[model samples]
Target: MLGATGLLGSKIYDRLHRNGHEVLPASRATGVDAYSGQGVAAALTGADVVVDALDMKTMSRRRATDFFTTCAKNITATAAEVGVGRLVCVSIYGADDPDAGRAYGYYAAKAAQERIYASAQVPATVVLSTQWFELIEDVVRRASLGPVTLLPAMRMAPLSADAAAAAVADVAMNPHSGPTVVVRGAEEADTLDLARVILQERGSIAGRRPRVLRQLPYLGRAIAGGALLPQEADTVVPGGIRDWVRAAH
Candidate 1:
């Protein structure tokens, strides 16, 4: 498991363990930096499969693109070299849809990451998911400016990170799940509204609270349009913002 210390990664590690698979987690904290090509080879020396739950949490285009592409290259190349049979990557929905946030750098970066795995010699499974309901706080933290919060005027089926993790673990444990799988939330929602709920429930984030919230559709047409919503979901996670917030606190 790559990025084993991350929020979603930790959940995935748990699920994989519950599924009775011996999991060895790899991340920067575990001395396995996929981007730097350090300790990755040794980590997968005898591993049969690798699940990359690695996440680059940033709104910056260049940073996100660089991080994903570099890390994907290193992981795929090294996995192929070490004779790993399968690679399971965790990504977002609409990563391959050009109209779905192509102008958004992070979307483009994720698309590039998917392509890297697709072209690899090792067989790979790409698990695409809608944004996790748990991520609203992180999004709020990044988008907040002083006493106000500005977010994308986007639509999301707010999936729970826990459910998404289960989907990844399922694909990791099975060989016939296919090359791609889409996991979505139970309900379609607005990002602006999700942010509002986050602030109202949490009161403040990172020691600061935003009294005002706004949403803009400037990031990309896909963000505002229905391009990012899942059309066919192999895994429809059961939860919404309200449920997430209730368990969040």
Candidate 2:
């Protein structure tokens, strides 16, 4: 697992290890730079399949593009150079969309990375999963100012990070001869509605009354109008907001 420390990467590394697969956790934490080829070869020395879960979490266009683009090029080159057979990557649901938000520059960066893999001779599969439940929490936190909270009225089918990670492991174990398999959550809920549920649950313990402001006019309309919806379906992971919260609690 390339990004063995992230939300998904940690879960993936654990799942693979617990399932009896000796999974190696690769990252800059281990002095292995997936983007710079510093320790990539050494880290991937004995690995048969590589799961790239490195996340470039930033709002800057240039930073995001640089991260994933460089990651894609270096990972593909090094994996092929090391003679690794299959590569599995965790990408966003709408990463291929060119009109996604500037905040979604990471998605565009991921897409650019996919382009490198697509052209590479190494067999690779990009698993595009929907936003996780924690993303809902992030949206609420970002929009919150004291008691008032605003969220994108947009729709989301938030998947479980653990399930997404498991799916990545499954794909890695069974190397596929395809371009990419897009996975979304079970059901679609309005962003505000989902936020309300999460806030209400967390609010019980956190002692905060978060008011939801949905789709206020102006730029809010653009945010509310399906800016983050998955257009295709391949594999839908199980679990919902309630399930996630229950587990977290």
* Count of residue pairs whose backbone atoms collide, per candidate: 0, 0
The residue-by-residue lDDT of candidate 2 on 1-249, one tens digit each, is: 788898889998998898899887877778999878899889877678888898866767689888888888888888888888888888876667665543356666777877877787678888878788777666656667786776546666788887788788778877653678777888787776676676666663234466535544232343345555666767786777877787898
In candidate 2, stretches whose alpha carbon ends up further than 4 angstroms from where it belongs are 101-103, 204-208, 215-224
State which candidate has the highest lDDT: 1
Q: TM-scores of all models?
A: 0.91, 0.88
Model 1 CA deviation exceeding 4 Å by range:
200-209
Can you write out model 1's per-residue Cα lDDT over 1-249, one digit (the tens) per residue? 798888989999999998889999887777898989999999987788899888886767789889999999999999989999899999988867776636687888898899998898999999998988777777777788788888877887878888888889999999886889999998898888887676677776545677777888877777788777987889888777878888867
The deviation in Å at residue 104 for candidate 2 is: 3.3
Colliding pairs, model 2 = none
lDDT of 2: 0.74
